[model samples]
Target: MRGTIQNRDEFLSKVAGQLGQRSFTEGVERPKWKYQPQHAVLKDAGSDELLEILKMQCTKIHTDFFVSGKSGLMETLKTVVSNYGGGPILTWKDSRFDTIGLTPLFKQIWPEENVEINEWESSRGEENIELAEKANVGITISDITLAESGTAVLFSSKDRGRTVSFLPAKSVILIPKSTIVPRMTQATKIMREKVKNGEHVASCINFITGPSNSADIESRLVVGVHGPTKATYIVIEDL
Candidate 1:
């Protein structure tokens, strides 16, 4: 009964009478909008074009962007990790890391054996938060890549914790070229389709534009206020 309407025709009949209508009915057609400029922006751009847009937006948001093939992604990831001072790395428990062939080098990605790596595990509960807070670098796979704002959309679930992206000082995000879309318009459409098709969409969808910054303290801007101070995005071409 959670999703069921309590009243059948009684409530609708009263409302219809007030509106001077005959009867209330289900499945009313949605009205088409007259001005739809949302669809006009970046209309049907190719993935390459979208990537270029993403790169350009990254400059304003203070994020680094890189393009790499499947073979080179591992090395690219390693370079990002090294740039962040050789973690204490935290990542999601995602199988795509194995599918994209990063699993093989999981142990030896970093040349230094002293580097510690951790994965977010739902089984661990609040223990995951502590690791994320202490981690130097946190890595995550982008659920959707918004080309317009250079945003990485993260779908949080049992295996993927939200804290992994925010608690860390630095974050490295892996984005598949195939997942890139024109903007929020396309991004929301995809999520709507997922719900229409009865897909299990995660409740918490994160639209992280870049390293967190705010101009609230003064008119002057301050970076790394609430979230990551520095962020890097690795675009996997052959995902």
Candidate 2:
């Protein structure tokens, strides 16, 4: 056994020697252009144009998109819940929801006996994960929306746990139109700025393009294997 272990060690050392130290240290060079051809076109687009592009790309990626004003948001959310057969919902404890008065709407739509609405709480560590796993739908607020890729950016923190977006079978994101950006570059810049300003940045930043899907097993496409099977984006125009 000792002889075999030594031989294996010798083989690994030889392989590492051949690769050399520089091979691991040297990183790939970044692209020179600020934006690629596809992304460049969206750089100067107006809010309306960006929204249109976001809608088109989201549709292509099989994500349901809905638009609603501040006044109509409650009805829109009710419709979404009703369409999903009124299951348990997990949501973030963000101020944005309070600003729009979502708590009352939730109470009105989903009564105590009918549906369970689990608002994220930091104190409930393992309990939160358990709730998220059982939750039929997870609802969150998107900090940034990449219009070019139709991606929603979520920064996981105490108020907004990562499990709410990942463990559920379906997800609903409440996105403000003002948070929509053209590309990832703009999003990263904002994140960097927050870090520089000594803000409480989250440990995990999730960039969700659409529903979780994989074609790994026999090349047959499967959805919701690792995450939500369906994702809905509610873009609030008045926010």
Candidate 3:
């Protein structure tokens, strides 16, 4: 491993020298364009307007959208889960589930004793992927949600693996309305701010819009080809 790293560093240093620099320490500055349209879209949008934008975008992306308060969040989630077809359910081992008062459905309220209620165990490794693949519905909360693209940005970690959202037959996104941004530009800015503030930025981030769609066979579009067959986004207003 040490030798491999040394060889990789040498290769990078040689490439840097060819790029008119002694090393990568002399990095190029980010370009600042005058006609910047990225930051312009929905720049003045309020929370309500953002929600409307997200709702409209979801229509085009083929995703179900719902609005609820913290009190109704559990009922809303259960409804979507049932609508998507009940468990075996898969969810992240996030404390936020308890913080927002939705943990009971997983730990106690869910009535189907035969169905497996699995919390992601990082130690389980490949077992996590196997269970996720078998889940009827997967539930996750958005770290950041883009209104323009109807995208839920989830920062991957050991406990909240990407498979929880990727491998399931159906998926549900629970987003706090406060996290909604205008578009990808704002999402990028948020991450840049985290780095600027010396925070530990996530190495893997998944920007899921809806169920995976593809038109690979005979020009006919098919959903769930690469991911979940159905997706629902529930926005908790009071959260």
What overall lDDT goes with each candidate model? 0.89, 0.85, 0.90
Q: lDDT per residue, candidate 3, 1-239, as tens digits?
A: 12334577688889988898776544769888989988888899999999999999999999999999999998888888877768889999999999889877788888444556899999999999999989998999999999999999999888998989989999998999999999999999999999999998777899999988988668788998989999999999986
- What tens digits encode model 1's per-residue C-alpha lDDT throughout 1-239? 12677886888898889999978387787799999999999997888899999999999899998999999988888888888898888889999888888875565655346778888999999999999999999999998999999999999999999999999889999999999999999899999999999998998999999999889656688899999999999999986
Pick the winner on TM-score between candidates 1 and 2: 1
TM-score for candidate 2: 0.81
Candidate 1 error regions (>4 Å): 1-25
Error of 1 at 125 (Å): 0.8
For model 2, the stretches where C-alpha displacement exceeds 4 angstroms are: 1-41, 107-109, 217-220
In order of appearance, the predictions have TM-scores of 0.88, 0.81, 0.90
- The best-first sequence of candidates by lDDT reads 3, 1, 2
Write one digit per residue (lDDT tens) for candidate 2, span 36-90: 6755656788999999999999987788999999999988988887787667888
Model 2, residue 144: C-alpha shift (Å): 0.5
What is the Å distance of residue 102 in model 1 from its true position?
Answer: 1.4
Candidate numbers, best TM-score first, in rank order: 3, 1, 2
lDDT of 3 at 4: 34
Question: What's the CA RMSD of model 3 in angstroms?
Answer: 2.7
What is candidate 2's CA lDDT for residue 29? 71
Error of 3 at 141 (Å): 0.7
Worst 10 residues of 3 by lDDT: 1-10
